[model samples]
Target: MPSSKDAVIASLIKSFEAAPRREQPYPHWYLEHCLPTADVAELTALPFPAPALGGISGKREIHNATRQYFDAANMEKYPACKTLNEALQD
Candidate 1:
């Protein structure tokens, strides 16, 4: 029997591979039901450190050239963030 992780990976691969794509303007596929509602809620609830802005306007790329939103340290700090990352990668 396939492990739960393997089964999910297989399912995701099948769904993504089977989805129709548009190649005219750009190549993109619209996938659905990839993540569960509860998982989404938990991920969103994770306290990812807010990006520090340079000026009054909330622009991350204004003075800060480095565009590091989800860093490795933060991922280790937050399990939900890591879970979301793993789901996206799968």
Candidate 2:
């Protein structure tokens, strides 16, 4: 059976190839519907920790304790994160 990551990678490749590409100073593609709506929703609904600023302003390094990331651990935990990471990689 194909894994969800494989399925999402196939969809993302197909969408990117089918979308229009514009090459000017740089080569780029405007990919649309890159991921399924359900997957996108799942990512949005993820309960990532949000640190309170408390009027604090600086780089994210300040709140490293409560910081959230899509690192290997999160990618392994979340299907949508893994799929999205795959889509962005070569």
Candidate 3:
């Protein structure tokens, strides 16, 4: 049997290849199982607090300081982030 990481990558590759390319109402594919259940849970469990937007709606870049992006530092710190990043790159 493949390892968990291998399995997730394989699943993502298969799902992405199978996803249809639609052009009608905006082109997009309905992908499923992009991430494992455990990985999803881990991501949702991250302790990053919500930004105090002060009732103002704007681009996500507005809270750049508060929001944690999946950069090299974050991937090194979060296993799920690393896994998801690798899977996408595959």
Candidate 4:
């Protein structure tokens, strides 16, 4: 069985991947703003979307909101999975 850390990591990766690719203002904002808070050198080593989202730009508020969304949704599944599915349920 996958270790808890591995499960969490896999879940996180899956959550990220399963997320809709269609760009939204919120994610775009996170990509822009939160990236700076991430490691610059470390981010540079990654590729594509990771690098894109890992660098600084703008939209910090939006990023926070996005995080909140995830936190609400995956409270059970991941504790911070975001309630995107719930939002869609409405």
- lDDT of each residue in 2-89, candidate 2, tens digit only: 2477667877888988999999869989898877777878887888957778888778678788887888999888877777777667
TM-score for each prediction? 0.50, 0.62, 0.71, 0.25
lDDT of 1 by residue, 1-90 (tens): 112434445556776888888797899997765555555566567665566664567653474654444567766876555655665576
Alpha-carbon RMSD of each model: 5.6, 3.9, 3.2, 16.5
The models' CA-based lDDT, in order, is 0.59, 0.77, 0.75, 0.36
Candidates 1 and 4 compared: the better one by TM-score is 1
lDDT of 4 by residue, 1-90 (tens): 112333444444555555555556555311222222223333343332322345555876644533423234333544222222332244
lDDT of 4 at 58: 84
- Which rank order by TM-score, best down to worst? 3, 2, 1, 4
Candidate 2 clash pair list: none
Stretches of candidate 3 off by over 4 Å are 1-4, 17-21
The local distance difference test score of model 2 is 0.77
- How well is each residue in 3-60 modelled by candidate 3, as lDDT tens digits? 2677678777777888888888998988987766787788887777788889877787
Q: What are the clashing pairs of model 3?
A: none
The backbone clash count of each candidate, in order, is 0, 0, 0, 8
Candidate with better lDDT, 1 vs 4:
1
Off by over 4 Å in 4: 1-3, 26-90
